[model samples]
Target chain A: MTTDDWVAIWLTAKLATLTTVLLLGLGTPLAWWLARTDSFWSRCVGALVTMPLVLPPTVLGFYLLLLMGSQGPVGQFTTWLGLGLLPFTFTGLLIASVIYSLPFTVQPLQQAFRAIGARPLEVAATLRASPYDTFFSVVLPLARPGLITAAVMSFAHTVGEFGVVLMIGGNIPGQTRVISVLLYDRVEALEYTQAHYLAAGMLVFSFVVLLGLHLLNRERRV
Target chain B: MKNLTLLAMPLLMTLAPNVHAAEVQLAVAANFAVPMQKIVAAFEQSTGHKVLLSSGATGKFYAQISQGAPFEVLLAADDETPRRLVQDGQAVAASQFTYAQGRLALWSAKQGVVDNAGAVLKTASFKHLAIANPKVAPYGVAATEAMIAMGVYSSMLPKLVQGESIAQAYQFVSTGNAELGFVALSQVYEHGRMRSGSGWVVPAQLHTPIKQDAVLLVRGRDNPAASALLGYLKTDAARAVMASYGYVH
Candidate 1:
């Protein structure tokens, strides 16, 4: 691959890593609330969290573009705070990716939290374990599989993001141009050989990652 | 028997158009979308042939055409892509002709932001300046050339934000994201003047002429409707529409 290709790959990796980390921080509490609550509001919030899975990436990206633009609400507020515009910046892409990958992190974690039941928490409570202590010592250890799954899924989803990134980021090299966009540029420019190489590399990498995930699941089950 | 008939209904519905009126699949560049729609409407009215217009970046259409896309005609944003198609034996060489000359404009949603001389480009007032992807759209190439001719290329580099097509470049400016952008004249032109935003029509001498070309693909060699549509594009009615959109013939 060319230096440009390498740059795109590195940028994509950085974007994916940052998005995954941020989503983990944001999604965990949301997922925990979703699993514990039975109210209509919780259902509504859960549906909103899962909306990205069904919503076309371009549609979400379009709204993100509007929302993060100079004339939009978020933009106006940011301008008031002297942060400038968000579109076409790395920060804009990171924010978009976090939202786009939210479901991937949240859904699995919700299922894990729900499956834990009240038995472990009751046992911890009987032992005079504080809520924080129970969460750290008991809940986290039990939820390890789900946490791993959420992190991996979020990372993979962000890495493969294209439409949303394209809509908001506008393809600025080293700032917003990720691997999928780079591949698109190569195809448009008729650089078929480079496109093929990049596509094949992604194909292999995705296959290996999924295979590893499956193996890890099986190992934990055994 | 009833179930089988029900299953075949949707298949029939999909095939019904081909069995009825003649249809021509046209691939149009993003910049020509508005005028192409008007031209297609007129052609359909006059000739009774249905035109299915698919608009996108010209480079994408070229890639799709080279890969055996179903498009019978291509209205390209640049002369070179059509010529390349002809040279590659994907299109009829004889059918290729310049359809229109596109105009580039520096547009802003806010009135009076852009002067006639395009001096706003030299100032660093706007953090983002939108332009189409130079590798794909001819208007973007013209914008780049104009910038270089004005001796502001290097200075303006940091503020550049590229859209996938001229249409999207217009969107960025219209939405107030970039503050200003280089877009096709047709996007902002209505009646005899710009509709809402201020625009500076870039001088032709500053950049290469954006000569849009139309050609019949090899797949359309046997399709009469494709040729008829191409012929209709050159008529007075279509030419008038093009002219109204600031396209020169």
Candidate 2:
């Protein structure tokens, strides 16, 4: 592969890692609240959170372009704060990726949190643990698998992000050009050998990771 | 009576589609989309051929054509792609011809931002200047060439934001994501005036002429609608629409 190809791969890795971290930080509270609450508000928010799952990336990208353009309210607010436009920057792509992969992070984490049940929290409370202590000591340990799943899914989804990035990303090298976008560029530039390398590498990488996870899960279970 | 006859031509043309109506799939360059749409509508009305128009970057179309895409004809943004297609044996060499002469423009969504002389590109006032991917789109190559001709290519390199196609480059300028951009003159032109925004049409001498070409693909062989569509492109009716959108030829 070319030097640009390596740069693209590295950029994608950074984007996915950062997106996973941000998703976990943001999604944890949202998923925690959704899991514990039985209010109608929970359902509404849950549905809203999962909306990205069904939304075509192009649609999200379109709305995001409008919302983040200079004439957009979000743009106006950012410009008011001296940040300028957000659509073509890496920060813009990160925001889009976080939104695009929110559900992928939240759903798994929510399910994990729900599976932990109230029993551990109740036991910890009976033992004179504070709410924070109970969550950190009991609930977290029980939800580790789900946490891993959420992080993995978020990272993977961000790595595969194409449409929204294509719509909003300006495709600057080492800034917003991820592997998928670079792969697209290579194909369009008629460098099929480079395209083949990127495509085959991604296929192999995804398969190995999945296989590793399966064996790890089996080992833990045994 | 002459004016009335001209008006009635379109009306009579609409009635011509019922007999021997057939569909032709076309892969058109994204830059030619607006003009191609008008041409398709006219062609359908006059020739009874239903055009399934698929528009995108010419590079993508070349890849698909090589892979045996179901497109009967290709209207490329660059003459090179059509010539390459013909060389690759994906298209008939004899069927290719220049369809339009594309013009590049320095444009900005904000009024008065882009002067007639296109001096804005030399200034560092604009944070991001958008252009289509130079490696893929012909208009992008022209934009870079224009910037180079002005001795501002190196200076403007850092501030550039590359769009996937000229349409998207126009979008970046239109949406004000980038303060200014290089885009197709046709995108901003209508009835001999810019539709919106301020623009400076780059002189043809600054860059290699973007000679957009149309060619029949191997897939189009034996398809009456495909040949008819190519024939329609050279007609006065279609040429008029092309001219209205700032295409030179």
Candidate 3:
């Protein structure tokens, strides 16, 4: 591929990376809280967070557009803070993707947190370590595989995202035009050869990311 | 007496088998949705023929037809596709005719944003411009032509946002995702008046004529329902209906 083609690849990588990081940062605490909390309200909140997994991406993007419109509450608040409109912009795409891929990261992390068993934390507390210290020094080490899985899954999911990104990003070339949207445009223009190349690339990319993470997890266990 | 009446019921059923309503599977372009619905309703009312309308982008329909879909008629968004179908012998030669002419318009929900002379695109104040994917939608090509004619293609290329089709292009600007968008005139015209918004009717000098063609597929060449529908589209009444929707006869 030429420099122009690489630009799209680079932007896609950047967007996917940012989305995965954001999801992890937001998801890690929420997953831990959900895993530890026994309250009914916490469980309800957990369920609500997982809801995006089942909802169609297009549906999510549609509501997100309304929420991010200039007249909408979020838009008005952001405008007051000097942040412009959200939809049809790169930052808007990042926000949409973070929500769309939240479950992929959150679910695995939640399961990992649950598997760690409160025993480690309890022991650390008895030894006079703070809750944050126990989390960083003990719980995090044990849940390494789960964290890896979450990051990889989230990144891979964001890479393949289509409907939501298309709806919100508006397919601006060299800006919001990721590989999936580019592939779609190629097909629409009857450029099937280019579309095939991009589709094959995505399939291979997803497989590699998943396989590499799984392999690393297996190695860590052994 | 009961046995004789039972035998007559079966005889009547067998005799009327050929008179049952037949399905006319149609692959129509998305822009023609409303007009096709009216025409289908009128056709069914006059001839009792059942039609199953499948609306999508013309390129998608063409792909399906090439793959041997059981569509009887193709109401394509452009003449070139139908003409190609004729060349491929996938459609009848004489059956191809321009049903309506598509008109491209630059529309914005924001009042006074677009003038009929397309003075808005010359200004750099607009942040985003929306148009359908030029490779697929006919109106998209027209939009690009208008931009190129206005000498803004190079400058505005970065800010252009492409929708998959004309309907979605309209949605992008109508929902205010983009400041303005290029879309089909039919999308905004209602009840003999333009919808509450400003739109610039693209001049013919900017682009090639968008002569939309409707053709009977090879499978429907002899089908009664397909023939009837094609005939109806050529009528003055149908032309008038299309005109109301901003289609040129």
- Give the range where candidate 1 chain A is weakest over 10 consecutive residues by summed lDDT: A63-72
Tens-place lDDT digits, model 3, residues A1-222:
555457678879999999998998999999999888889999798888888898988899888877887656777777788877788788888998988898898899999999999788899999999988999999888998889999999998888888898788777766788888887777766777777777888889888887898789888879
DockQ winner between 2 and 3, please give it: 2
The sequence of per-residue lDDT tens digits that candidate 2 reaches over residues A94-189 is 999999999999999999999988888888989999999888888888888888889888888899899999999999998889999999999999
Say what the interface RMSD of candidate 2 is. Answer: 0.7
Worst 10 residues of 2 chain B by lDDT: B11-20
Residue B50 local lDDT, model 1: 94
Of 2 and 3, the candidate ranking higher by lDDT: 2
Per-model root-mean-square deviation over C-alphas: 7.4, 3.3, 5.2
Give the poorly placed runs of model 3, Cα more than 4 Å off.
Answer: A2-4, B1-20
Which stretches in model 2 have alpha-carbon errors above 4 Å? B1-16
**Model 2 scores what on Cα lDDT?**
0.92
User: By descending DockQ, how would the candidates be arranged?
Assistant: 2, 1, 3
Local distance difference test, each candidate: 0.91, 0.92, 0.84
The TM-score measured for candidate 3 stands at 0.91
Quantify how close model 1 is to the true structure by its C-alpha RMSD in Å: 7.4
Which one wins on TM-score? 2
**Residue B237, candidate 1: how far off, in angstroms?**
0.7
